[model samples]
Structures are given as C-alpha cells and as structure tokens.
Target chain A: MAYSNEVRDSFSKELDGIREAGLFKEERWIKSPQAADIEVEFPAGAEGKKVINFCANNYLGLSNHPDVVEAARIGLGTRGYGLSSVRFICGTQDIHGHLEHRLTEFLGTEDTLLFPSCMDANAGVFEAILGDQDIMIADRLVHASIVDGMRLCKAMRDTYKHSNMEHLEEKLQDHQDKRIRLIITDGVFSMDGDLAKLDEIVALAEKYDAMVFVDDSHASGFIGKTGRGTHEHCGVLSQIDIITTTLGKALGGASGGCVSGRKELVELCRQRARPYLFSNTVAPVIVSGAIKVLDLVSATTERRDKLEWNTKFWRDGLVKMGLDIKAGDSPIVPVMLYNAKLAQDMARDLYEEGIYVVGFFFPVVAKGQARIRTQLSAAHDQHHLEKGLEAFAKVADKYGILGKSKKEIKEMYGL
Target chain B: MEEYKKAILEYVIKEYLEDDEDEEITYDTELISGGIVDSFSMVSLKRFLENKYDIQIPDADASPEAFDSVDKIAALVVRFKQA
Candidate 1:
C-alpha cells in the first residue's frame, strides 16, 4: 500500500528531478564483504550489469580481517548474540564497560560511552548538555547528525564558516553572558577531507569563554600518531572539551560510535542522551570485537603509517597529473570536476576500469565544486594507490581535465 | 565604506578565482549559480566577510543570493555592517 495516487505521484516528480539532476543514488547489491576491491551485482530485475566495488567506509581494511572476524565469532560464542534491551535496562554488558574504558584511555579522555552509530553520537550530544540558555556556534560544514541534534535542543545555535576561527569569535562575541557557549566542528570534514584547525579553534574557545566539541568520525582511526583523532593530529588533545568518534571506519569496520571527554560529559550522555537511553544495545559480538580492535590500535602504528603514506602517494600523483585536487593534507582526495555530468561520467568510467570511488556534487558540496572523492586507507598498497592514480590520470586526460585543468576553468569563469 | 567595498570585492574574486588574474569583473556576476564560487571558496568568502569586514551572516545567507556577484556580496556586506 502507498499514499494516495496524487500524493505518490507528487513525490515521484521530485524524485524524477533528482534523477534528472544525476543525484538520484541507487545501491548495487554487494556480492562480497567490503575491501579494497569489491564485487557488486545488480539483480536480474535491474538494468545495470555487475560492477566492481569502490565506495565503502572501511578505511583500515578490517571489515573482513581474519582476527577481527575471529573475535566476533568468539564473542558470539561466549556472550551470545543480540541484546533486545537498551543500555540502561539490561542492555549493558561487561564488554561494553571494557570497550568504553579502553576508548577513553586510548583517546586520553576521562570517560566514554557507545552509540549505535556516529550519527547518534552526535544526535545525543546537544540535548545532553545544551539547554534553552546555552549557545552553540558550529562550523558551517558539520555533518547532518549534528544539525539534527541541535534541532532537538533549545540553545541558540550559530554557525561559523568552515575553519574560520575569527568568524567563530565574531559569532561568539555577542554571547558572552550565556550559561554555556560551545563551539562544535567536525575534526576532519568528511567531504573535502580537510582538517579543522583545532589549535586555532581552541585559542578562540579560550578567548571567548566557550567549550570545544569535535566529531572525529573521519579522523579517529587514521590521522593522528596513535590514530587517536584530530586532537592528536593537532597536538592539542588536552585542550578540547569533547570528542566523538566512530568504530565503523579504520577501527574494526563495524558499526559503533562513542563520545570521549570529561567524565561528567560522558556520564551526562550515558544518562540523558535519548538514543543511549532508548536505543537497543549494540550486538554483544560487535562490542567485544570492537574491544579487541581498540587494543590492536593501541599496540601498533603500522596501519596508520601506511594510511599516511598511501594518502601522500595518491594526493601527490593526482596533483602531478594536473588534476584539481583539494589542498587539504587529509586522506580525502577530491579530484574536482566542477560539472556534475563530468563528475558522474568520470565515476562511471573509473568503475568500469575496476577503480571504486564516488562523485560528489551539489547539496553534498557546493555546486560547481563537484568532485570524485578518493579515500585512501592502510588497506591500499603502493601498487593499489599507483594503479588508482594512473587510472584517474587516464580518465582525467580523456575528459580534457589534464591539459585544461580545473584551474583553467576557474580562470575562464573568474572563479 | 569605499575601502570595505574594494577589499570585499577583491576577497570575493581572490577566493573565487584560482590565479588572481583581473580586477574588472562586474559586481553582479553570479558567484554560486554562475559557478564562480563553489563550497570551499564560498566558505572562505564567508570568513572574509565575517572577520576582515566585521559582518555577521546567518547560516541561511550562505546561498547564492548573498554571494551571487560582486554587487550582491557588497550589498550583503554593507547591510550586515550597517546592521
């Protein structure tokens, strides 16, 4: 059953616009677990044929790690499967406590608490500490989950332009008397893969009498020395007031999120965060597995170092190819193709050549900044990075992007 | 007012353009919709307006309207400064 025919048709019209705009996303059925090279197939009913996988959040190559897989199995054997209850009500397990403590220690924070996803880690935060009297000034480019969380609170919400500490201070200038003035930003912006200038933000926070909040989902498992997050990368881990991160990326390539910060904030989220109180507990196997993942991260920097090397190789190669890649040093390499159609065409071509990456255009990034976002991981070898770079260069040259780069296009457009 | 006007225009062009080539682009040329400025530079422009010029912009003003062209951005800057 569906809505009335008129209403149904009305929604379809907008969806058709999405298709026309080339933003209509369709998922391909994956025939294998996520990895550097994925195999995906369309069912018999669909129009497209089988394709290799390229887009996944698994940055550490651990989604299918034998050791991680074994840990999941062992946890299941010892702890059983799902917990039907939420954390407050019969959902908390001994492993949950252990994992939280490990994350806290690893992050060099006072405490930590888990969420079903990084999205909820953000969703739970604003309402937990912010109230009608509080004020939050966020970076304009923070993730959607943070926006949703802000909506749930009554605090006065403001946005500073991405990474602009001066603008953040200007926004904070008027709120000098609020009960709380907090600055929130994504530690590493997910789309462009640029890092938030935490040192500057911390200075602004101190000058303006505000607390700091950062979501380290994209940066947590790979950027810093010990893979701690932007805090470590910024070398200001102790100055920030709050840090939220994900286990879904470089950690274990499974789903879980957490907030690590002052013991009070962690305790506050545990008791007052709606999702934590209402959502079902994460599967026991996932928690236990994540505990082991944290331990592995604590033990070595091999994977993290590989990730940095791989990122430099890819970023530098794309630049040498005369492509317009964003300048941020983070692992996210956006090969800019301003035209949406060109971005899509490039992505389609890359898929055909067995390279997996996604094209991001308007609404995700600003219009006319359309790009192919290439995420590099420890899982990628030198050969993999070189192959991806070579494939990108070939496709870019074929599209007239090599000799006539995004720079030339900007020159013509006066932008 | 005159210096603010010049600096704002220069900043907009510098943020929009890759190589700081010309200074005569019209004030009303579209920045976002005309594809002169994308998300990254739009952000840079916002910071320029806020910090260098002391103008306050709401999140909603991030659209093409305020940043559409030199004139529109100048107008936005003036209105924000006056306010």
Candidate 2:
C-alpha cells in the first residue's frame, strides 16, 4: 500500500514518454579501467567492444598511471581504507593535511579544504560564507552545482549572460547596495568547453569591491601554461577569493574535491561547511593518489603539453572534415548536431565504428542545441586521433551532415 | 511597440512552445513561472530581443518578472529603445 500501483503507473508512463522522445539515457558498461581505450558493452549484457574513448574528463591521462596507483596502494597500506568519522572528528589523517597543503601550493591559493566532491564543496561554500544581506551574481552558464549551492544560501541570486563582462559589470553596478556582492563563475564551462573571462571578471570585482569565486572543476588540470588552472592562465592567480576544483577529472580521476582560496574563507568553510562537518572524510587512498598527481604535474608539463597538442590536432581534423563544432581551445570539443534524435543516432553509429562519445541533448543543453561532446586526453596518441577522425567521418557521412551548419541540420531533422 | 509584442509572441511560440502545440499563448501569457520557458530560453530570448532591437537591455531590467509575458517583454524593449 505504501508504494501504490497508481504512483508506479504514472512514473512508468513518464519514463516511456522520455524514451519515446529519444531522451532516455542508456549507460554503456565499461569492463576495463578508465582509459583512452575502454571496453564497453551497451544494452547491458552484450559482447564488449574496445573503443577509443573521446568523452571522458581524463585530460592528462593520469587516471591509471602506475605511479598514482602505486601511491594509492601505499596509502591504503599506511593510512587504512576509510575514515569512519568526519574531518573535525577522527577523520583528520596526516595524509589529509598533507594533501590540503599540497593542493594549496599547487593551486597558488593561501589555503585549501577538502570535500567529498566538488559538488559538496560548492553546496557548502556559499551557505558558509554569505548571508541574507549579500547577493550572489553568477554566470548564467556556471555549473549546476553552483546553482544548487546558491539556492541553499540565503543571499539574493542573479546571473549575467555567459562570459558577458558588460552584463556582469551592469549587474555589479546594480548590486552596489548589498553588504557583499559575490561574483561566481566556472573557470571553464563544462558543456561548451569555453573558458571564462576571469581577468575581466577580476577587474570588475575589484572595481565594484566584490568577491570573486570560480569553480575550476573542468579546468583544474592541464588548462593553463603550467596547469595551475584558469586563474593562472588569466594572470589573476592571487586575485580570486574562492576556488573550488575537483580531483575527479584529470587529477588521477579517482574522487575528491576541494575549496582552495583565501585563508579566512577556507578556515570558515572548514569550520562551517556542513558537508565537511557531517559527511565521511575523503578516502586516504584518493588523498594519496591526488598528492601524487599534483607532484607529477608540478614536476613536468609533459602530459599537459601532449594534451594541448592532441586537442588541437583533433579539433583541426574535425574542422577539416567540415563538421560544425563548438569553437574552444580546451580538450572538450562538441560536434554540433542540433537535433536530439540525430545526435543520438550519430552517437550510436559512431559507437559501432569503435568511438565512444555521448550525445548531449535537451535538458543537458538548450533545446535544438544537441551535440556529441568529445574530450581529448594525453593518452590519445596520433593513432587514436586518426582512428577517431576516421570513425567520425564515417558517421558524419552516414548521416549526410558533413559541411552542414546548425540551421541546415535543424531543417533536415526537426528539433 | 505592438509590432515588437507581435514579434516577441511569434518567436516565443515558435522557438519555445513548439513542442506544446495544444497550449495557448497570448501577450499576457505567463512564460517563466508557468514553465513555458526556462532560464536558458529566457537568456536566449533576451539575446534575441537585444539583437533585433539593437539595444542593450541592462541586466537589472531583465528580471524574470519583467520577461514573464510578451506584453511585459515589449514594454521593457520600448524602455530600452527610448533610453
């Protein structure tokens, strides 16, 4: 009686509607470790096919590095597996402190505080800092985590057009009456793969006497000249007030995130962020692995350089084939398909051709803006790029969409 | 101004409410709160208006309340045009 048939029937009908609309997402089971080439089996139990993965956030190919794995093993042997308590309790391990300091030094921030994930860091940071007298002015295209975090806080929320410095400045001028005005933006937008105008944003914040916060989750590794992140790339390394980034992506691709920023703000989060106070601490294994990742990136920019070259090569290849792609300098590249069904069909066809990339459609993006988002990594060599290009060309040819613009695609397949 | 309202109405119906053919929309129809348009769509709509009118609408005047209906959107546009 608690779970009634009527409720179940309504839920079932909604799920069916999603499938009929071509919006139902199906997971492809990966049999091997996270890598550029992974064995995937779709529709659940079929045979696994090895495909060149172009949809992962593994920018530096450090996900399965031998040194990182060895460091994790050592951490497990030394620090044990899981912490039963939170950071304020018995969860504070020596390695945790070491990782925090290491991240502070790596990110060029005054201090850092670890979280279960970047999502948690974002969720807790806003509420920990701002109050009702303040306002949070964010970029419209900032990560969803930031949106949720702002909702949890009592501060007034407003958003400027994505990367529009003029609009941001106007918003800043509008909110001069507030006790504090916080400008929030992603260092790099994940879906569009576009970097934020952090230098302009920093200048605006300075002029308006506002605080600047950046969630560098997508740009934490292999983004700048030396991989210090967007702040470093924008020449505002010490000007940002708060920075939240993830260890989940290019930093060994295990799982951990942190808020690295001003010493007082970081201390405030450590003392007040609910997730840090209540949730279990990040595993020592992840912490140790992240330490190794920071050390590797700090030691040399070889992986970062390789990833940059791979992104350029892949982007040039796609462009040469006359496919419309979102213009970005990052490793994340999206091939614009426009229609949801076309994107889904193209992703399926590309999968059959031994390429692993996901179709992003409505809800994930705007209506009529569906695309196949492809990410490149240092692990992807010239051979992988060539093979990926071949597979994409075949798929594009199959759809007869080569050289077609978004308008043309929309006209062909109704969005 | 009436022409602006008509253009805004036509664009909203064609671009946003295309999937819901049965739904009726008018100059006073609720767009954001009624779920006919989302934040992303609103941003694009704002961009459309700016591009069409060749006027920059300040973010302060581009609130959800100001853009909830075609009549309100047109009024905002006129305010910017006059400014």
Candidate 3:
C-alpha cells in the first residue's frame, strides 16, 4: 500500500529542508581495504584514485594487517563463519569465550560481555540496570547512543554541561536522594578529541556514592601507557565501575564491542541486556581478528607509539601551517573552519588533492563549530604524513584559510 | 520580571552568541524552534531559572514547548514564583 500524498509530501519536505541546510549526510565509497592509503571512488563516476586516508578509525592500522587477515582465515577454518543464534541459545563458542576472557584481561576488568556493537552495549545496559529510584547524570556532549540509552531507562535523567565537573556536581547533588546514581561520559569526545577528566569524575563518584561509566570507543587499544583506555590514562583504572568500548576502532576496525567492568555487572548484562540476549552472536572472524589485535597491541607499544608520533607530526604541521587546529593529544585532530559551507568545501578540496577527510558541522557539533576531523593511523609513515600535509597546505592556500602569504607558506611547509 | 528576562538573555548571549555578538536576542526570538537553544543549553537555562527563582520544575515541564521563547520562559517563571 502507498502512503497518502500528505505524508509523502511532509517527508519529502523535511528531506528538502535538510538538504537546504547542508545537514544532509553523503556516504563516500571506498573500493579497497581499510588502510593509510585507499582507493576512493568519486560520487560522480570519476576514476578511483589512491588517497591518504585521514578519516578511518584504523588507529593501530591492524584493519588490513597480514597477521590479522591470517587470524581471520584460520578462524574461518577452525571456528566457522558465524552462529545464527544468540549467545545463550547455542551461539556461545570456544573462541567467543576466549575472546571475552582476553578482553577482560586486556581491559583489566573482572569480567566482560560482548555485544554486536558498543552502540548496543550502551543502549541495552541502562534499561537493564537502572529504575525509577535511580538517577542518571550524563555529560551533554556524550555520544547519541548514550542519550538513547538514558531515554530508555526508568531513571531521573539529567545532563551536565560538557566536561564541566561543577555542573556535574550540581546535578549529582540535586538528585542525591535517589537510590542510585550513574554518571555516564565518553572517555574521549570524538569530534574534538578532548579527554574527559576521569580522575575528577571518579572523585565526584566516590563522594556521591555513584557509579562511573566511560564509553572508551575512540580511546581503546591505543590510549594510555599500555593501550588500556581512559581509566588507565587517568590513573583510575581500578576506580571506574563500568567501561564500554568497541573492537571496531583501534582493535582491527571490524565489528564488535564489549562491556567490561565488575564481574556482577557484566554477568547481569549478559543475562538481562536486550541486545546481547536477542542479537546474533558476533561473527567468528571479527572475534578472531579482535583477539589478534589485542595480542599485537599488548606485545609491543610500537604501533601506538607510531600513531602518537604521526598524530603529533600531523597536528604540529597543521598548526605550523597556520591552521586553527584544536589542541589535544588524541590522534583524532579537528581543524576548525567555523563555517559549515567552508568545511564541506575544504573536505572536497582535500579529497581532490588526494587526501581523504570528512567535515563535521552542527548538529554533529555545536553551531558554528564546524571542522574537518582528521584521524591519524600508525600505518601512516613519515612520507604519507608529508604527502597529506602538502595536500592540506595546497587546499588551504587555494581557499585563503592558510592566512599566510605564498612565500610564507612555502617557507613554513618547505613546499 | 524584567530582571528575570535580563538574566536569561545575558546567559544566552554569554554562551551561544559568541560568534554572533551583533545579533540581538529579543523576548520572542524563538530560542527552541529556531535552534538557537539546544538540549544542552535548555538544561542550563532550566537550572539557571530554577536557581534564580527558587522554584522546582518537574521533568514534564522541562520541555521545549514550555520554554521555547523568552516570553514563555518569563511566564513560566512568574507562574512558578506565584505558586
């Protein structure tokens, strides 16, 4: 049956409004594997070209690594492709249990439970645990998944100012009469790459008798001394109550996530969380790939060191070139370009110059906070960084965003 | 009453109008529908009003329609202050 004309017109009109406001999201096609340099097929049927990828979540560059590929191949041979049912219903395999145990050890948690994605882990945890007598206070800048999770819970919900401990304190005190309080935050805010002050949050949690939860999706497998994530980085690994992170980012860039924390909480999620209880078990290949990534990252800090070096190199180069880059240590660096149209144009120009990056604007961020978010990878060597820098310099020069004379740019970039 | 409006306007300007300093924020400036105020800003506004007026705003009343414009928020403040 077809929808009525009124409904069709309303939907089409809203879409038109989105397009007019430049908020429409367009997906770019990548024809090759996830890597530092990739073959990108243009939207207009243009010839595909190898471009330096600065937008992928392939932080440790294990997405297409030889060892990771071989592990997946072996997994296919030994563990099979998938289990068509949920974990409790004949989906649990030896590899699944092994991966869960490996994650628990790696994250330094008492136990762990896997989900289809960190998104599911986040969405399912709140409703399963919290009730009307509880209060959930979250950072306003947390990922949308957290917001949806909070909405599903039967708790008194409040959002503090982004990274504002004072506001968080106010909300915590406001709802102190509640039976339980849960503080939710993203370990590293994705758009700006700013780290949450976990030490302060832990202190507040202790004072208020609240549990702290950190979604370390963007920080896992590459942050801290041994790549254990924000809790480790903040020196509060033992204090954090719950941690939800993805294997899709630095951990091989495949598809799986887990909730790792206190043993009882993890067991509760395994039994009660809707996503884990209802969704199909994670594929054997991704589980094998994730285990391999953990082993590789744990054995040596070489890849993370390279990623740190590349991030500093690229971020410092952009700064030296007079770009308004946000100050942070994370590999996710955002170069501010205020205007939405300008950000979109810059991304297009960067792509034409053989550098792949994406523009973020409101409502992905606050209004007037448009930027080009460039994610660095360990696979990016010195030459790759130089080439990407050259492309960025050229694009900025063309658009006058470099804010420097031609001679100055050449001297600074040695172009 | 004017004092309440002034405080809210000042807060909005100090926070959201960093880039658009020249743009004026009047009483009927459409804070919610126009997207000048978002979820984060709305909560801040709610807290500011609650603290300043010494009133409690129930969760059901903490909505966009209840405080879409400065006039509506001003009315809400008056209603609660009287109650």
Candidate 4:
C-alpha cells in the first residue's frame, strides 16, 4: 500500500471530521462556458438548469466575448497549442512579447514578466527578491498565495492589522533594524471588496524607506475610471515598487499571471524566477485572448461603466431590502448572513429562484462572518439585475432577514 | 492582573468587533476557538501585548491554545511579564 494502515485510518478520520463539521467543500459542475449565464449540471433527478451567474470573476463580461473567442481561435491556428518547452528553451514567442509589453504599458510599469498563473507569479517573486537581511510586513488579509510565497522566503515576517495603516507604520518602525523592509498588500480585498489605501501606503513607504508590492488580482482591468487598478484609483501608480496581477480574473477569465515592475526586476525574474524559468509559458490561446481583452477594455469604458452601475444598483437594492451588506464600492458585494447555516440556506434558495451565488463561511472567512458573495458583471442587463433583486427579496423574506434591524437580525440568528 | 485582563479584552473587542456596541462579550468568552479572534487578529494582539507588557511570547506558546481566551491570555501575559 502507498500508506500504512495507521496513517490511512488517520486520514479517513480527518475527512470524516471535516464532513461532520459542515466544512466539506463540494464542487458544482458547470456544463457551459463561464459567463453571466451558465448551464449547471444538477444532481440526480434534476435536469441541467441555466441560471444567472453572480459568483464568477467575469467582471467585464469579456470571458466568452465573440471577439476574444475569435482571437483565441486565430492564435491557436497561428501559434499552435502548447509550448512543450520552457521560456528559455524555445517558448518565448512574438505574441508573448506583445502581451508582456501591452501589460507593462497598461499598468504604467517599466517591464513585465509572464507566468503560468498569478499564484505561481506570487510564489516565485518573494523568494526571488527577499532574503535573511530583509523583513516583510504584510496586511493580515492578503491572499493565501502571498502568505505561501512569503513563507518560502527567508525574510522575517510580520502581519499587521488589515487595512490599518497605523499598525503597519508601527511594524515598520519595529523592523527598522533590518537591512531592507518590504511592505505588501492586495490592491483590492476580494472578500470585503475594499480597496487598500495605496496612496497612503506609498507615502508611508517613502517615509520608512520600504519597498511596496501590491497584488492587483481583483482590480486590474476595471477598477479605476480608465480601469488601470488600485494604484490608479489611489493615485499612486508611479510610486509602487512592484505589481503582481492575473489574467485569470478581469482580464479574460483565463489562467495566466504577470509581474510588472522596474526593468531590472523584470530581467532578474526572467532569469531567476523558478516558475517562470522552469514551467511552460502561458498557452497561446490564453495569451492572445488576454491581449484582446486588454485592448477591448482599454479602448472603451462602456463595459466598466455598466459593471459599476450594475453593482451600485444591486447593492442599493439589497440594502433597501434590509440586507446587511458589507460597505464597499467594488463589484464584489457580500451580503452578510452572520450564521453559516443561514448563508448556505439562502444560497440554495436563491439558486432555486434562478440566481446563482455562493455562500462563504468559516475558514474562508472568520467564524460567524458567513455571507453570500455576489459578483456583478457588465453582461447582466437591467432585467437580470431586477430579477436578481426579486430573488434576493424573496429569499431574505423567507429567512426572516428582511426589514429586521441589524440588531434584531443578529439576535434572531444567534450571531 | 485585572488591568492587564481589562486592557487585553478591550483591545480584542475593539479590533475584532470594530467597536460595534451591539455585540455583547465577556472575559471568559472563547477568543481563538470560538472565532472571535482569528490567526490574523491574534498576531496583532500578540504584538500589542508584547509591547505593552514588555515580554516575549515563546515559539512554543504561540498556538491558539496559548491565547484561546481572555483568562488564558491574561495568565500568559502575567507569566511572560514575570519571566
């Protein structure tokens, strides 16, 4: 056997515990492509259902756009499918260089390096730069990829209060004895849809002489007026030291990531970053499609404007219905349920009503902070928004979450 | 000891609850396990307590077990202060 009986028994017991604790994650299969509306394969006795998708990262609704799809098809015909070799060993192509250059231009950075995924980009950056002489101070709510990346490095690590600039300043002061200090944060916190105060962070970095790195995964393509990112929204695009983002979310809803920064850093990462040098480069289809996505988003702000308007409309509607929504301007709106069972029940009820959203609870978030995260897309029309609101109202009424004051809701839910 | 306990509990409530006056809490309430205080919050609390009490929390005592409740956290503070 691959494992001893004792070990296997322990593993089975752990899985049992997870199942009993209501923490077992079950994957729901989708039959159609990712978009505002998708066909989901239901379990036995239930036929496949087409539902309004409110949980995907398809913010700009360009994932399955006809133009992007056509671009990918042409790219596959021109460049073929897989690289079958790493970038150093015959993988770098003209399209890849074009994508990197376009990203650097779009992000207002000096250079950019591509990777298989944003997670890999994050995984490779920290270890490639920081060492024992450096110290890293990160926000408490940074993505798990960054936490793993920092762990792989030899730098002394400290986490400050989430979005608490004062706490960060104190940590920077405490670590002033280190040779170098790096401050890291996410451009937009996904769970809460809150933007980091990058302008303030940049000022503090200057004051403390620390380098700043931001993972702009959640805000790259459609955040600011021109859709630059948190840096643009916060007015510190030129001040950030390094930026890591993804093509997986707002760019194309495909899988790829990039690290954009100074020319020296990009050159260094190309030469030394393990994931970039060892792994196969991004697929031609994803690359070409992502390039098209950038062009489409940058050329016009119609999709971005529509997404923002839809988010505001839906968020205001939820609030008007007395739902306790987390306060933010990002399209990711979290309807706070407080109780795990209630969140799950609400998600199921909404799904039955033809609205698709996912419930998030403990481990993914803090305990007692259960919520239904609804992501808005430009693809959703006014009719879809109204229908989603109607579904939310019905579900909220059924759960006794409507018209109750925040206090009453908390008391009734035992929160 | 009473001062230390009061200070620690107040900080936890303010940090985690964001000064929300609606949620009632007590010193004996479970902090780490009950999820009122997560790992991230624990890091902030640890740093604050270390600075305020002038003590170092050893690596062995950094688990949720050490700072599970207000009472346990107070005791750890006292022990560290004495050490």
- Fnat scores for every prediction: 0.07, 0.00, 0.13, 0.20
Q: Judged by TM-score relative to the true structure, which candidate is superior, 1 or 2?
A: 2
The lowest-lDDT stretch of 10 consecutive residues in candidate 1 chain A is A44-53
Model 1 complex DockQ against the native: 0.12
Candidate order (lDDT): 2, 4, 3, 1
In terms of lDDT, the best-performing candidate is 2
> Candidate 3 residues A1-415, lDDT tens each?
5799999999999999999988887777889999988998888587888899999999999999999999999998898988788999999988899999999998888999999999999999888787899988888779989888777788777777678788789778887898999999999999989999999999999998999999999999889999899888999986778999998899998898999998988888988899999999999988888889888999999999899999999999999998888789999999877777778888999888889999998788866667899999999999999999999899988877686543443344321
Supply candidate 3's per-residue lDDT for A405. 40
* Model 2 residue A234 CA deviation in Å: 0.8
What CA root-mean-square deviation does each model show from the true structure? Answer: 5.2, 6.0, 4.3, 2.6
Stretches > 4 Å off in candidate 3? A4-9, A403-415, B10-26, B34-37, B40-61, B80-83
- Tens-digit lDDT string for candidate 2 (B1-83): 88998999998876565452356799999898766776644756786899899999887888999999998999998888999
lDDT of 1 by residue, A284-399 (tens): 89997898887777888888888788778887888788888889878777887777777888998887776877888877876567788888777777877777877888888777
Select the stronger candidate by TM-score from 1 and 3.
Answer: 3
Name the regions of candidate 2 deviating beyond 4 angstroms.
Answer: B1-30, B33-68, B71-83
lDDT for residue A346 in candidate 1, whole number 0-100: 91
lDDT score of residue A164 within candidate 1:
68
Deviation of model 2 at A136, angstroms: 0.7
- Angstrom error of the Cα, residue A410, model 2: value is 2.3
1 or 4, which is superior by TM-score?
4
lDDT of 2 by residue, A364-404 (tens): 88666789999999999999999999999999998889998
**DockQ score of each predicted structure, in the order shown:** 0.12, 0.09, 0.32, 0.32
Would you list the C-alpha lDDT of every candidate in the order shown?
A: 0.79, 0.89, 0.86, 0.88
